[model samples]
Target: MNTYRLQQLLYEETDIEKIQKKKHNFIIDLPKYSFNYQNGLLTLNDTSFFKKNEYLFINKHNRYAACPKHCYQFIELNYMFSGKCTEKINGEKIDLKKGDILFLNAGSKHAISSLGKNDILITFLIKEKNIKVDLLSQTKGFLNISMENITPFFTDIFRDKQYHVFRNNEPLSFEQTLNNIIYEYYFPQIYSAEIIKCNLLKFFLLTARRSEKSCPDSQLEPHNSILLSQITEEINKNFKSLTLAVIAQKLNYNKNYISNFIKNQTGKTFTELINIRRVAEANKLIKHTNYSIAQISELVGFSSKTYFYSEYKKHFDHLPSHDRQYSAAEFLKV
Candidate 1:
């Protein structure tokens, strides 16, 4: 295409999408990348044909391409600011919408697809040194932490720290908070390595916390939340073979207290809450993939298909087959 024609094509395409339709090969060689921040538009740098530049990844593709399979040196994160991207990672497939945060950890192989225009993403290719110490320290704020001893590596990254998120809109005040970090706070000193390390760690913490707003332990009642968390952990690890009696005995509480506790905190009786989660997983498998109804039934902790289906319909108001066949958006209509 001629330059004029290409420029004209580009001009006609406003808010173009940044994604591909085909899967990209996962490549190793992930590195720390950075972009120049200017008016909500960050530039993507190119590091290798298979890999993008250090600090950030910026690409605009309508077709699917192989991503560099998971590498050892870096971790990848992408926040969809607009449009959507269907991703296939290792073996799991996920559809990312605006406001979603996707993480590709070290050694995690993945690929992606583009939907249409307005499908922009803000990405971070975090370096290993940044991931090991700095990111952990900042994100510890999200969890219950009591760090007494400061590691030398952590001390360096903490010299100046700030956090940022992509794809979600915030009030002017919050946006200004983001601005202060990007421009004012560490301000890219001669120790660019330290400055970059700090901001990236901050971003990791901010993004991780944003996704965990419904923290079980941070609920209205701390004690109740802690109990619920233990219950949840038990169910998660053994939801398939779960028994209310077993959980009640394990917590040294009467069955009635356990039942009432779950009801008061989660607004669902013990059995009902269990079914809620079991059925929720069933719904995801049903719509997002081609798992057979019977298969999904087992996967979600149902030992008996009949019982699973019965409980599923009771809570979801639809047969598992019908609900699973449709995406969450479509299921709501029914």
Candidate 2:
């Protein structure tokens, strides 16, 4: 990710909370942000990697804000290999210079201006996911993360002005880490992305294990995992009748026990878990189809209009009619 994109992700995530940076060698603070379209390059040519053509934005931009510039899509990390700018990350503003690396989470937006003409930057484009399995071996299933995850993890700390070094040739540990990552991961062609992927799994496993965002309870036991998978299948097949009691009857577990088990093992109630899928499908229909809110509501199994509105608002913080217009930038703020 370049400085431009880093500014964008920051501009987006600033809505929820300020993400800080972690400490490294030479410099104490590194400021970064995310971008809009930084990851499109992975396609166009390489057929061997990331098969899915769709890129998911971790950020949702502020289309209505009067901003100097905007990010499109992509997780970007901006290493101020050397430069200066008055930057905005998800609307949060900062002054940045040399010896700083700014992280931008996916889909976040930001703006930047006022810079040295000689400013040079290094970028890392990545995707973040809780690591699905182990890198070296799958002996123990643990939650891991991608570099895409770190760009957001250390965002706030990098913004600390006390850590910036005005000097051009810097002796910062972050620089070294970046150098090591680039040289070690990108240079050697033998299993390059795989090695980086593996190391990324390790790095996240070491630090993110304790993160509040990590869903520990969702890690299913072998038997229960299979059962839950089956339950998920049934829910999709029969969302209209996929109640806790009905699901338990078919699976041979008591209704109350099944409800408690689902929450304990998945950290989501039966209704919440099922609604996640339903809402996802509804969102797609709202964005891609010409169906009215009422039509879409009925299609998604909401028999009552008021209940559908309430549920939709609870999930997206916007009405169904409101989000049906993402294609309309001017309509977003309405």
Which numbered prediction scores highest in lDDT against the true structure? 1
Per-model RMSD to reference: 14.2, 14.6
lDDT of 1 by residue, 1-334 (tens): 1334423442233221222332233222324463233332223333432232234333323323334222323455565645677776534467777666565554344455634445655454555453455445644756453222222222322221111123344421122222323332223446544554455545545544543453333555777767888998988777667888999999899998888888777656777667767877787788887778999898888889999878876654457766654565685687
lDDT of 2 by residue, 1-334 (tens): 2445434433442321222112111111112322222322111111222335321111211222223434433445555655555566533466666556555545444564533334444455543332332232432345453343543254432332211122223332355345434554434566755555555545434324323233333455688778878887888898754688889999999999889987877657899877766676788888878888788888887788898788776665457877766645545666
Which structure among the candidates has the greatest TM-score?
A: 2
**What's model 1's TM-score?**
0.40
lDDT of each: 0.52, 0.51
Off by over 4 Å in 1: 1-73, 88-93, 130-205, 208-214, 229-241, 244-334
Clashes of 2: 43
